[model samples]
Target chain A: MRHPSYLLACLYLLSLSACTSVTIDEYQRAEASLASGDRIVLLGRRHSPDYETEPDLINCVGKVISANQSGISVIPEKQFVDELYPWFEPRMAPMRPERLEYLMKQPQVREKIEDLKLRYVIWIDGSTQQTGSAGSVGCAVGPGGGGCFGFGTWDDKSDYEAEVWDYQKQDLVAKVSADAKGTSYMPALVVPIPLLARVQSNACKGLGAQLREIFVPDSSANAGA
Target chain B: MKKQLSRSLLMLSSLILAACSSQLTVKGQFPSPLTTAMPLHGAAYYSPELISHSYAEDDEDRVKWNIQTGAAQQEFFDSLLPALFQQWAGHSPDPEGEAFKLPGVDIIVKPTLSDFQYSLPRETRSKIFEVWIKYNMQLYQNDGQLLADWFITAYGKTPSGFMQSDEAAMNEAIIVALRDLGANLTVNFSRVPELQDWMGKRDSSVQQQSADRGGVQNETP
Candidate 1:
């Protein structure tokens, strides 16, 4: 009976732990870039870039790219991979600057890049890793049946950064970053309850919002209050 | 009296655990690959006894069970493999191929369940209920020629805090296994020498048709 309260307290404390977010850095239109307006990178420029209507704009953009169909070129992940085959390797994604620079030199590559009509090459990259976990668990197994007993905690940190490369200028311009930490627990005294980290998803959304800000040009954020 | 009370408590716990056992099933196929229908013959054989019918828990090394869930190896294998095969290979013209004798059956797959278990392993201060399955696949030509025979093992693990139940873990593991199985068949189907020869012998136009289809695979054998 007392154990449940103790576990709840632990969970409460864990949830209270601080969460980090992405910082949308300063960026400018590359000299070679096309002039465009607010549109989510996920949904291409078919719909109008109406930011007020989509309050959940931050949630819409998964990593860095705005998913609005109107402003950003929303190339399907499959199509992007297939069309840019030999170049757009999904396994080896977030192509290195040097590699991208080399590819931009090729006429055919440049033609394809222009063909995609990508104004800003948004590279959203990051991963969540379990940094540390500590605790002990023991289970009792017998003919009657088996159950686990023990308490443990796992530490996980999600670190992600988004980089926007201007293909026209052939230069890296904007960078946004987010980092958050979380903990998971196993309180399997009689019954088990697991509290996994809320790190990666938070980092993704946090970073995504900042990237959207840069693309959407938030007047509220820019205006001096 | 204490012993009696403990027994009663154990019985009550067993009932509750049984109720908590999940009913998991794989629904729908991924997507059909082949344009044409190929008759796949034979049933995937899973010994229910080999894998305990109820939920079993392996604590790192020790294995024990107390709850009996509705999940069965045969039910899972029967429902999943056909649809999986369709997605990976193409189409199974005859999903229900009859016995040892069937007409127009070019390829037959005999799948035997080797090892199936859900375990909770302690790693880096976390308990992961790892569901794993090992199965042997025997690919044979219609003329009873063994084209290829191999074993595949696949697993799915969820941390102690995230996993629903052993049955759920088992279901995920099954899906992973079948996914692997489908990929195995698709990539290796054309590589079977016996199948190639049999198809060529049955119809001389088979090679010509394949050539016309421009079917070139990376792993030809």
Candidate 2:
């Protein structure tokens, strides 16, 4: 018979390897495609007092979108924010298409946008949170040795929405939302084994893929403008 | 064996104690604002107190934090002023001086730190370290008449990640707050009512001077 410790290890490892579930929902207004030299920028929403959409997630989506040979170019969030400075700051950033229109009226701003060849601005808003947690892990150190023992588990949920704005057109063209959920486990024998779920990463991939579909449809027949 | 054990225990206790206190210097670089400078010569004065600002907080849990951000604040304004005005000059800090009389200086600006506050993840029951900074900006005419006095507030927060040190998180928060401050100042400089009135007068004076010169030149021609 297998020892209980071995069984626990096997069981926990199996559970930790469980996959995360991600769902993507998209709403497109007609169709849109990127032309040569057209670039896109992904910015995180920070106006919310309680939470901030993490920059890492934005970078992840940007990378995923450009990963495929779709000729989709993405501007780094930091570079874009820096180039635009004060205008895209949390307080002054336009949260709506109408506000963006007003901002584009400024000659300086309009000129800079044109120079950047920026076609789309994707505003990402959302955060990953530990929805629920149970169990506990305790650690103790003594003269002889130190070790941690216990079982802990927590659930994480990531919900994000990306709003695509056609900068030249000064309007919202598409909206893509991603939701991902997973459970993480930590089972400690002599040392704690943390099995973390890629909850936010999964959400990012889903959002990125759906955004790609908007510009580069799955098939040429599916392409629309 | 017993002696070795005692040594180990003492070392462990010392390590735990060391983790309770955090001290860090906030450091960051500010990007030059990408806007057309106003057609005015400006001077900024950074007081000694504002350039040496620091905050310390101690709690019953023996958690001690000391954050130094004065240097960063000085750098932020130093980089921003030059880019925000057509002509910019920084003079020696003088707390008692009422007015500045420098050649071609149209406006004088003084920024002071009013308040600073922070919350740790444990206190807020969240995995985020947050900071808030309040500043009071005073704009003056070359002759010391106060043109505008207003408050600018900025906030920053970073979520705690596994294996991330408190110092790193707090530093990130401060950087974010500083960037926010720059953004607010740049975007809203003319939005202040008093400053708007001053700009209106300044613009009209320039227009009157141009018209007078034009009339003279036209008559001579």
Candidate 3:
């Protein structure tokens, strides 16, 4: 027979483990065929009238992809931004479907991508936000010092999407989306120590791996080596 | 030996009790009616101003419709509404994750819960005991333009004792409101004059097409 204490310990660990996830939802997929000469860039700086750019997440995923160094040439986010700055500002901003179509039809834009051999421009967008929380974690503020106690859990979730535009072909070839929600605990022990979920990490890993899988086709060859 | 045994027993008890801690989550009503009705596309958000006031009204009975934690309240709306809108608008790569933030699409929606009230059930089949949700929503372009603004109220009419026990009716009321909001947006969006103005600026072809069609559709349900 199993010991009750052992079972209890297992249960405690299981609850903690449940607070992280990696979910990959591919909206559209690309051909697994190798594009050896094709260069791809993940556009990290999202063109938004509102909301700050997710530089950390952009860099994290970029680093992950560059580390893989697979078939698709990862052009690096910094280089991609710097190379296309000043120009392509109005062209890349998110707009209506018809407007984007018109943009892709532009002679100057098409020529630029063709000249650069920039086969794919993956527009990446995502953010981490708290979803739901339960219980109560309160605190006090004073001169000597502030202390917080009580137990509460906030649901932190990371959502990411990549729109792969075949700039040369002037078409949106693939779209990859990953969103994960995890609960974070704020246990008040004189101060609120937040056990944040690795939402961004999970999303980054999920998206990076999926992008590689779709574009690179073979991942094991690059694994560990 | 006795003290060690007692400590182990206490540890075991604590672990068992930990599972019983209040596990709160925000849920959404599914299969929005607008999905099939309107084959359109759009984005959604929850403004920080609206999210800043994330509290539900308290009950004298202290029973239903009481969202004690502000974070949980915000999360519930953030996760649920945008996902619903994504499907309703036929948005590929849905806007659930980017709720209340700029979605960078043609049509932008902001859903704010202005107020709500939950009344406990008195009888088994009485409409008197109901939950109400007052929702304020807006649709606009990314370029700081407002298209449509709608203020809607939804009712959750439950005649059951179980439904009213823990503010279940109130949550249901919210779903009702969201469904109505989706349907309204789908039917009424094309009627927004600003959308035509937007189309004129973004794509001249669309404006030409509008002129060729005589005019943009003026019908609204």
Candidate 4:
């Protein structure tokens, strides 16, 4: 013969303890990994840009050319102007036109091209459609195991993608792809916010590792390149 | 009497056991509503370089955009305004319908360029986009009286590296702006009790007027 009050108290405590927690340590690790190098450049595309893979290919090649022991220099093939500042007059007034023109022609701007260096570049392409479900249900299991009931469930999904390009010889060296998915309850006790960050970090990590493998070979010739 | 007391205790125990065995669960349902609002009506105004500090005279000669931080503040706001309007509108009582009646709020957002300096390993140099945007909002009443005036600012940085497409960089800027705006708005709204009350009342009145008209009010003005 067991006491029912004791069992009820135990159940309440157990349910309360089930609350989910988020770990900032995971985010810190991801941030630390990204901050480790200075030469690498991360570029993202809005949707997938359709071009003869040349620009993409060239960017990858640029990465390989820019690769150094310090880190790889990744550059997007296209010059991204700030749409927010379309008209160059006021926003760029402080920047001397001649200076910008000169900088573009600067040896450094053309570093990898002139130096003939090898580097790694990643281009994120395409978005993903994700789906997920979550819920809670209250039920009663009798001595005879007859009474059972269902409570609730939830589902959600978001779309995004990353296309990674590794440049080694002014040619596309390597390409990698990653996707993110998320779902949670109404108030999203555990999933949405924290999970979204995790998804992004994981995707970036995957893309980075994949690009590293493609560009960095174990052979002596390519070991440092 | 003893037997009766024993039976009562047995019943009490049984009731407790039964209650404990059954679980009570509550489920909350929330539609994944689009959190963005229609773009706010505003423009990014650029001014000539307030101060020039670069050593390169050629750098000073570049035809600067209205605002000289690497990215354009106006373009960023254009893409971002609609979404922000939609988000702010969404949080309101009549998100879909009453937003338009409030008339478009006029916001002048300007970005101040600060400290765009970067150094390479052996002293190679690059530029940084250390920019801050100041948002001046004037909320107008139907009668043209300024209902609320607010000033909010946000900061973001673009390190020296491969410059992505203008659109991509702009999108990133917008995202940063939106995040900052959300936080600023949340804090502002929470702290200003009178504004919140006024907004609530105005929305309710708008809803009532629509109901009296026997039709829904169109959100677009």
Question: Model 1, residue A29: what's the lDDT?
Answer: 42
| Per-candidate interface DockQ score | 0.03, 0.58, 0.01, 0.02
Interface RMSD of each: 13.4, 1.5, 19.7, 18.3
- Residue-wise C-alpha lDDT for candidate 2, range A169-220, written one tens digit per residue: 7788999999999998888887888888999989988898888888887822
Please report the candidate that would top lDDT against the real structure. Answer: 2
Docking class of 1: incorrect
TM-score of candidate 3 restricted to chain B? 0.51
How does model 1 do on interface RMSD, in angstroms?
Answer: 13.4
Residue range A60-134, candidate 4, lDDT tens digits: 434543444424455344332121122111222112223334323434334533242323334444332224455
TM-score of chain B of 4: 0.36
Best candidate, TM-score-wise? Answer: 2
Candidate 1 lDDT over residue span B1-221, tens digit each? 99999999999999886674444443323322221223444433333343344444545444344434224444444544553233233222222345444345556566666666654443223344455567686665555556667777654443333435554544544443444444445445555566566656767686677776675553465
Model 3 regions more than 4 Å off: A1-18, A27-34, A44-53, A90-116, A134-147, A220-225, B1-221
DockQ of 2: 0.58
Residue-level lDDT of model 2, residues B15-130, one tens digit each, is 98778878899998788877778878888888888889888775666478888888998998998877778988776334237554555688788899999998888988888888
For candidate 2, give the lDDT of residue A93: 92
Candidate with the larger lDDT of 3 and 4: 3
